[model samples]
Target chain A: QQQVKQSPQSLIVQKGGIPIINCAYENTAFDYFPWYQQFPGKGPALLIAIRPDVSEKKEGRFTISFNKSAKQFSLHIMDSQPGDSATYFCAATPAERGGADGLTFGKGTHLIIQP
Target chain B: DVKVTQSSRYLVKRTGEKVFLECVQDMDHENMFWYRQDPGLGLRLIYFSYDVKMKEKGDIPEGYSVSREKKERFSLILESASTNQTSMYLCASSRSRTGRGETQYFGPGTRLLVL
Candidate 1:
């Protein structure tokens, strides 16, 4: 039940389009959900995150929509630009003091925005 | 800003050789994590340390081991390197949180090639 399944392994869009990546988990214990963005030859960076208590979170042009009952979450990029092209990963962790548990990551989605 | 640093940006090792990947964080975060990222497999946790001298095995810890001799350092060891172990290694650190919103800071990552 630790698996976080992600879909649309790859996505292509125009410079001003919206690209969405989706992920689902079966573990009910997960309380924190985060999305990470990784560029070529770089480590993944935290993009945006959401908790099960909140249905949605917006950070700049990035947003996270979470569904508690559906056990799913999604990342939406509004007005995606070429600079936003990167491999995105969805991760989850059970809440712990001092962050004891390591994050469980999805397979990843490769996003490309054409000019 | 939290700074997580890895020992190397790229490494090459022969099969059957022993390898060590080191990570250090300057933020004095209590939690440290080691993960391996592959093309289609995403990021898989190898191990984590909640505190000095305390280590825990993650989801895919079969052929790996970890060391946390100090609060600032964490190491991932491959006793016998294999071709299948080639991947991008990431180290992350996070502060212990009283609430549910904890974010992890990642290093630049080390790319290992086992021949």
Candidate 2:
């Protein structure tokens, strides 16, 4: 049973266009939603995160639109650049402290910003 | 800066051989995890540990085992390597932030090939 599901295995967009990746979860207990970005050789890094209490959060050109009612979240990259072409993963966690096992991650989305 | 380091960036092993992958985290985090990433399978958790000598099995722990002898180190052991186990292995650590959130830090990842 995949706890979290992501759509569009691959995505391509113009250099200045916005690329959106969405994810949905079946577990309503999930409280923390985080997005990670992975380059070619490096590991996935924390790009942005959101909690269920907030509807939306923006940091610079990256924005996370979270809909708690729908149990869905999406990441939007504004003014996408060639540098943003990479793999993106969405993950969720239900742990409040450190007792729980770990996070549940979506498969992934390969995003390409065409220059 | 939180840093998680894996023992090797690339490794190759023969089938039926025992394989060991080590991970170390500089940050004094309470949680550490091991995951295998494939092309379409994304990141699947193998094992996790929250404290020294404490370990838990993740979603996929069929042929894998883990040891947490120290707080900063976690080791994943493959009882017998198989060709299907060839994949990118990633280690991550997370610390509890506030009361309801955690930020996971990942290593550079090790690419393993079992022939």
Candidate 3:
């Protein structure tokens, strides 16, 4: 079973436009939500993360909006550029596992910013 | 800065042959993970270790096994390589801070093909 589901398998946006990717989880045990970005020929890297305590988090041009009650989270890139084009994945982990259980990941979203 | 290195960027193997993928992390992290990434499947954890001589099965550990004789190195072994196992393999490491979600750093990834 896919515990986490991501929408918009692929996306394209104009430069400077805001591109949003949404994700939802089915397990209530999940407490940590993180977004990862991957470029071709490279592994995924941590972009930003959010915990249940906060409803939103922003780092640079990346922002994660989390809704604890709905078990959903979304990633928004502000003033996205062509360089921001990559595959983005949303992942979750249960607090009970103590951060050692590894992560459950979404199918991934391929985002492209047109010049 | 955290650096995770994989043994090879690409590899090719024959069916029924034994294959090994090695990973090393320079940050002295206590947790290490191995995952497989496919076109539509995203990243699926195969195995993880929290410390030396310790290992745990992730969601998809059916055709793979792992070893962590040392804290800095983790190895993923395929007992009998198959065409279906051809995919991109990734290694990641994170600090072992219980209860709090830690950021996971990833390597460049190894693309393997089985014939």
* TM-score for all models, in order of appearance: 0.96, 0.97, 0.98
For residues A1-115, could you state the per-residue lDDT of candidate 2 as single tens digits? 9999997799999999999999999998888899999999888999999999889999999999999888999999999999999999999988575434578899999999999
DockQ of each: 0.70, 0.58, 0.74
Scanning candidate 2 chain A in windows of ten residues, the lowest lDDT window is A94-103
Best candidate according to TM-score: 3
Candidate achieving higher DockQ, 2 or 3: 3
Candidate 1 chain A weakest ten by summed lDDT: A93-102
Off by over 4 Å in 1: B97-99
User: Residues A10-114, candidate 3, lDDT per residue (tens digit)?
Assistant: 999999999999999999989999899999988899999999899999999999999988999999999999999999999999856567879999999999999
Q: What is the lDDT of residue A51 in candidate 1?
A: 84
Consecutive 10-residue window with the lowest summed lDDT within model 3 chain B: B95-104
User: Compared to the true structure, candidate 2 yields what TM-score?
Assistant: 0.97
Q: Between the candidate structures 1 and 3, which one is better when assessed by TM-score?
A: 3
Which residue pairs in candidate 2 have backbone atoms (N, alpha carbon, C) closer than 3 angstroms, thus clashing? Answer: none
Candidate with best DockQ: 3
Candidate 3 residue-wise lDDT, B1-115, digit = tens: 8999999999999999999999999999999999999999999999999989999999999999999999999999999999999999999999884747878899999999999
Chain A of candidate 1 compared with the true chain A, TM-score: 0.96
TM-score of 3: 0.98
